[model samples]
Target: MHSHPRLPPTALEDCYSDLRTDSPLDDNSMSRLGSEMRHGVTSVSNKPKSADAFFDAWIAHVNETAVYGKESIDPTRSTSYRFIWRSWCKYLASSQEGPNAPYTMANPLLAVPVDVSRFLASGMKGSKPGRAISDVTRRRYYSVLQRIYAFCASQAWMECSPLDTLAQQDIPMAEKHTGSILTPQQWDACTRRYGNPAGNTFEIRDHAILMLLFKLGLRPEEIRALRVQDFQIGIADMPTLRILPRSGPAQERTLPLDDQSAEAIQNWKRVRKDLAVVINTNKALQADFNDDRLRAASDTLFVTRSSMELAKVPLLNLVKAHIERSCSEAGLEMPVRMGPQIVRNTRLIIWLHSGLEVDAVAVMAGLKNRKGFLHLLDYCSESVKQKIQPYRRRDDDPVSVTNMLKE
Candidate 1:
């Protein structure tokens, strides 16, 4: 461990300026950044009296170590976090300039406790365009700041941390769960009406997505991350879905697919090509892409083709659209809050009542740690208890998904 007065910010400043302006540095300068960190550094910490000095160093630390719910082996997505932190720094740099300047930046590190919450809640204006992030995105932003500030406290940069000083009302609470949980009866109505698509723009794709969320309980990111090749089904074997490591909390894991869900996916794959052709030829859709990311890696199960909405908007909003349509077409009532999460919770609760051991259910639900699993305790009250039955392998029923699907 080492502790000393902060290195002059210019040392880091000049390094990045040269690297950025020069448009790629020589081997020596590259080495200096460490493989551009430790020369392959996994960890480093610098305690700065002012918060500005902490930005680059703290980013490097998270690049080396961020994990999912304190459980994933893969690090948190560094690129996205860096862009976000840069915005925070700009916000802090401009903080003292605003008429409502919250505090002096005599030492910005020291002012974190007083100013961070305000900065996050404030929406972007001008060049950035649009309103601030949604509740989901806001939680992610809070998590990123919390991670660094926690480190700041460990290095004794600030006493405790801003999060510790804020009153409960001041802190952002976990976003509320979307609407009520779906009962098996409601889900039956939703799923039963949606058979193989007859005629719709993305009917096959929509049905496949609903099956994954409602039947298999995958998160939206997990579904979006799936590749055309991730679904594996053979003549004799039941289908399985592989959830790959994605940008956010989704970690790599595979799940068993129920018979109906697998069939739904296969049906989509048959027509998936037609949609790809639309994205390829539709100038409006093609123009929306700023990069060749989707074109270059076209294997993703749910291919994204536009910035009409941001990274997640297309998928998340589509779930709401499809589920609402599904329920309406079937003449069933829609949940007050419509999102993929409600679709997922319905299926997961079904697993719980099916008597899959709680631990097994945790793994299936992608809950890597107990803290992530504890929230489910709310649905486990006594009234629900009488309905849950024991689970087992029937000697005659070799297909697990079939038995699991039997309600």
Candidate 2:
């Protein structure tokens, strides 16, 4: 059993007692959550002035900045960025205050080294959901902290960013954490079970969405942002989808569209037309159209019958509900956990099984590297494993290894 470090007699006992319980992070525990920043300034500022204040201010600043452009900063990512700052504050509060205090505050967040180590350790343990975070994300978190401290120091907030000294510390790349995807056979089963009815737009649309993700390996946001113009039937009559660039300035990709998905898209487009006046002409879309840049945006992509506005979460939930309903109808075990992106993994595995090169598969999936693709192999079924096995190499001898000439 781990004992509490050198703390006060009563506090030390409390820490140790709390540690004895299996759960250190109880929701009801006040100390674990940290003090909420009370806004009315104390004589020295009743509000928090130390680490928490800096992070809170930065979050507000960035969120406010996100509103200026035609494309707002992603709300989900902004929420996460805020949470990351809060996590930092939690780390700071729990650390030991050394003999010599550099600042006026009695306690600083964990010492720079300690928190950095803790963050890296937390990443390695696969504590974060959606599989473990990529090494890039871990590195970004660390770098973001270093910047936060630098920002504080520049403002004379703290003597220095606690992480400034960690520059020399080697931060190793984290192992890739891959997600699950359904196979072609599994997908065929899912679609047959869910879709195929005349008025089953719900199932058909979802099945199509899943198909698009599997066939194209589109990112969630890219899939969500799809518009009517993104669909194109090539001169050879091949259906194709133009996947727009993601967060950064990346090249858009034109992915081949499957026939079933194309038929589903046409169905959705028809339904979208019927519901346009009812759903698409909402205040939000009108607001969107007010901007010249957003004027060309269409209302016929993915949307909910509940509302005209294209909300990411609501659409995702609707898709999941349809899936569950289909599972019930088909007598298949309902997935306890699933997401829109699992199809991307399915596509990656299929590509590998079809003997496509890793680089080609990466390009098709819009992945910048093969690391995640390789990691995804872990989730593949044994049949897919066998299917994905490399073929025997052949030598060019101009002679048949086996001749049927033997009498």
**Candidate 1 TM-score over all chains jointly:** 0.48
* lDDT for each residue of candidate 2 in 141-190, tens digit (9 for 90 to 100): 66556545543433333333445444344443433454666544445545
In model 1, how many backbone clashes occur?
4
Regions of candidate 2 where Cα sits further than 4 Å from its true position: 1-176, 183-188, 193-197, 200-204, 249-251, 276-290, 293-300, 325-332, 374-377, 380-407
Top TM-score model: 2
Error of 2 at 98 (Å): 6.1
Provide the TM-score for each candidate, comma-separated: 0.48, 0.50
Best-matching candidate per lDDT: 1
Model 2 worst lDDT window (10 residues): 392-401
lDDT of 1 at 86: 55
